[model samples]
Target: MAEINMRQAISDALWEEMERDEKVFIMGEEVGVWGGTYAVTKGFYDHFGAKRVKDTPIAEAAIVGAGIGAALVGLRPVAELMTINFAFVAMDHIVNEAPKLHTMFGGQMKVPLVIRTAGGGGRQLGATHSQTPDAIFAHFPGLKVVSPGTPADAKGLLKAAIRDDDPVLYIEHAAMYQVKGEVPTGDFTVPIGVSKVQREGSDVTIVSYCRGLQLSMLAAEQLAVEGISAEVVDLRSLRPLDMGPVIESFKKTNRAVVVEEGWPSYGVGAEVSTRLYEEAFDYADAPIKRVGQKEVPLPYNRELEQSALPQVADVIAAVKEVL
Candidate 1:
């Protein structure tokens, strides 16, 4: 067993993958010299050298385009986009090229690429830089989306994403980088398209991912004090969403509170709520409640930013209401 933070776990995943597979290389802006925008690739420059850790210009499209091209040629390229808010600049390559290469070419080629970026609004990076548009990426077909909450999932999911033969959008929460958790040291990889039940309860089920899962866990602890047992189901993979565990949890709890950091409308929670109604409507005792961001441009002020996101209190109240 190894105790590590999400950042370290990701670094470890990158290091191990590159060591295991020579085809696996990293390319992005400031990835090598600056050690990545979040220091996730801190020592990669020295260990992997400039060849394996090829830093490129500031153009996100070029970074993504180059990654796709490399993947088509049998290289497993892990491209970094600094922050996911910048993904829009590279959507041409992400949505058009990477996802289409495999099928567009009649299955003759494989685009085994992974684009990694971070999201979340707690840091007050403002509207331009602070956005959690996970559902936006997951909305597209042929792209695997992964947003892990704990260190174990972070390491496991990243490994799986790199190994997968399709393009993956790996969104990490900015706030979770320093959050520490126990992770396996030896060979381990959590399969993509699965959900993990973080806590067992019967009153209400809290379905969330990334930082939202942390908030749900916090709310669960408080709910326990009030005799309301709220189960926490962490949706580790967003696109290939493991709806099975969510259905099972809702069936047992009879109530659900869908939580996410993205906008409420057309969000992951909305999809989950709809599915719960479709597959497990009879099991639900009350209408599902959802908690998400305030749907406005993220504010730069710390107080406004904090108020804009779903908080522990919001989850608690929602759980109480659904229960």
Candidate 2:
């Protein structure tokens, strides 16, 4: 095992995968020469060379469209859209095209492509840049969506996405790049659409993913001090969501609080809370509570931005409400 930050873990995954497979290449704005906007691919250009590390125009459509073309022709391309907010420009390609290619072509073709993008509030990116619309992409069929909260899951799942035959939207939290955690060394993958019980407790269940997972863990520790046991479940993959762990945890706890950085309405929290009620209604002791960003455009002001986003206190309060 190795202790590393999300940026290092993600960088390791890309570097290792590219080294292992010649077909794997990265393309996006500032990816090659700029070492990626977030520096996840800091030294990839020098190591992989210009041929493999492509730096394309600012157009998101061209990036994703070109990626689909590359994938169809027997290449695995990790297409990076500077931000998830920019993905809308390439919506047709991502949701309408790449994902449906294999099925639309009667299984004769495969779009083995991964769209890498980051979303979340904080750092004062403002409303336009800080939207968390992960649920929108997850709603479309034939597309795999994954958001990892820990360094280990980020590394493992990214490798898995790069190697998958289907199109995948790999969502990362912009604010979590510096967060550190334990990651196993080399050559392992966490299967997609699987949920993991990150922390076990008997009193209540706190379900989340991405940045919310980090907040929930912190809230769990605080809850423990007050004699409240809160089990934390990380929904690593969203589209083919594996509710196994969440259901089991809810069965044991009989109460749940779903937390997410996205808005609550029709968001991850809404979908999760709905499924919990439908699948495990008999076991539920209280109405499942949801903790999410306030329904408003994220403000540019630092204090206002933090206020709109879900916090540890919000999660803790939701957990107590459900209990």
Candidate 3:
């Protein structure tokens, strides 16, 4: 086992996948010489050469459109948007062309494309760059959405996304890029639509993913000091969400708290709460609690930004309330 940062793990997954499949290529703004905005693709250009690791113009729509075209022709293209916020500019290509192409064509064509982007707030990136739009992509019928919380999951899920036959939205939280964790040396993949229990407990279940997953784990640790054991479930894949683990955890804990960085309105937490109510309402000893960002735009000021997002203290408070 090797300890690596989340960004490095993702870079390794891309490099290995490109080597394994000639159809796999990476094209995006600053991906070639810049090595990606977060340096996740550092040294990729020199290692894979210019053709396989290309630098595209500043147009996000063009970048995604080109990737979709390449996928239609049997190429696996990994398109990187500097931030998930810019994905709005390429929504038509993603929602209309990329996700819908194969179904629209009656399975005559396949779009094996992976769109990787950095999302979420915590570094004072401001409202423009801090939006967590994973829920928007998860709403689409044909697209698969993945958000990995740890270095191991980041590497494994990226490999699976690259090898999938349909479009995959691989979201990386900006705050977790530098987080370090143990990652295996050999190739491996975590299946999509699976939930992972980061910590097991018998008191309460906390469901979260991405950076929120890390926050929930911290909150769980603190809760343990108070004799309240909190089970944390990381929903790695938002779209094809695996709620079985969550339900099982609820059965053991009899309580749940869903956490997310997005706004409460139409957020991922809301969906998780709905599923809990639908499947395990009778088994629940307490009402499902949801902790999410306040229903307001993220502010540029540091204090205000902190207030806009969910924190460990907030998750702890939610768990306490549920308990």
Per-model TM values vs. the true structure: 0.98, 0.99, 0.98
C-alpha root-mean-square deviation, candidate 3:
0.8
The prediction achieving the highest TM-score against the true structure is 2
Number of residue pairs clashing in candidate 2, backbone atoms closer than 3 angstroms, sequence gap of 3 or more or interchain:
0
- Write down the lDDT of every candidate, Cα atoms only: 0.92, 0.96, 0.92
Q: For model 3, what is the C-alpha lDDT against the true structure?
A: 0.92
* Clash number by candidate, in order: 0, 0, 0
Clashes of 3: 0
Off by over 4 Å in 2: none
Worst 10 residues of 2 by lDDT: 119-128
Model 1 earns a TM-score of 0.98
lDDT of 1 by residue, 181-265 (tens): 9999886798999998999998889999998999999999998998888889999998888899999999898999999999999
Task: Please give the lDDT score for candidate 2.
Answer: 0.96
Scored against the true structure, residue 17 in model 3 reaches a CA lDDT of 98
In Å, residue 86's CA in model 3 sits off its true spot by: 0.2
